[model samples]
Target: MVTERDKELIGALQKGLPLVRRPYAALGERVGMGEQEVLRRLADLRAKGVIRRHGVIVRHHELGYRANAMSVWAIPDERIDDLGEQLAGEPGVTLCYRRRTAPPAWPYNLYCMIHGQDREAVLARRRELAEKYGLDQWAHRVLFSGRRFKQRGAWYRPPQPAPEKAEVRHG
Candidate 1:
């Protein structure tokens, strides 16, 4: 069961947080808890699988990595697990996951994110990955991010109170 304290944390996350050196301490003050209590609860939540992870979200593009691509691969069913782990071990590949491949429509089954200084650099790393994994026989593609819509921390909240509606009167 979700407790009231959980709801409070969720609410704080949804409304966003203040930018300060001790942000958690400020958050604790608002929620009637000390900074250590806040940190302890967060740790407990993670241990119980209530939260996956808490970390900084970096903007790769802002860091001069202009070229970003999602490189996907279709590995033989038997080799998927081994190959995925191998690719994940690569330095430049940040994100890697196994996905279903819809043949004739979608041929890539595994996905990895590669960010680099430019297109040429990204392509070069992709080539290195393909050769390292011996994926010449497998079909693959690099899908670059044309645009980003919404990227922010996940917000957990209950149904919010709706805004007051204006009354309409017929003349």
Candidate 2:
């Protein structure tokens, strides 16, 4: 069960951690908590499944990686784990995972993202990975991103206090 303090902590976290040497301490100050206490509470929340995951949302374009391609492949179910592990460990592959096939329309299951300074570089990297992993043997496609979408963390709002009732007297 989440308490009022937990709600406050979640609300503060939704805004993203402050860019500081001691980010947790900053958060602790905001919620009237000690840094160590805040850390322990966050761990408890995670253990109770209140917090599922914590990750970074990178803006590749600002970092000079303007080109992005999502290379998808339809690999044998049994081999996906092995191939995915190999490709994910390679350099230039920023994201890699498996998704359920959409069937007749989309059969691709395994996917990996490659980001580079230009389209040529991204394509070359994809080709190198494909050839090195024998990924070309399977049906695959490289879809270049034409645009980017806003990325941010999840939001959690605090509970609002109830309004006080006005007193009434018979006139």
Error of 2 at 32 (Å): 2.2
Stretches off by above 4 angstroms in model 2 are 1-4, 43-57, 149-171
Model 1 accuracy (lDDT, Cα): 0.75
- How high is each candidate's TM-score? 0.79, 0.78
lDDT, candidates in the order shown: 0.75, 0.81
Of the candidates shown, which would achieve the greatest lDDT relative to the real structure?
Answer: 2
Given candidate 1, what's the lDDT at residue 36? Answer: 93
Off by over 4 Å in 1: 14-21, 147-155, 160-171
Q: Lowest lDDT 10-mer window, candidate 1?
A: 162-171
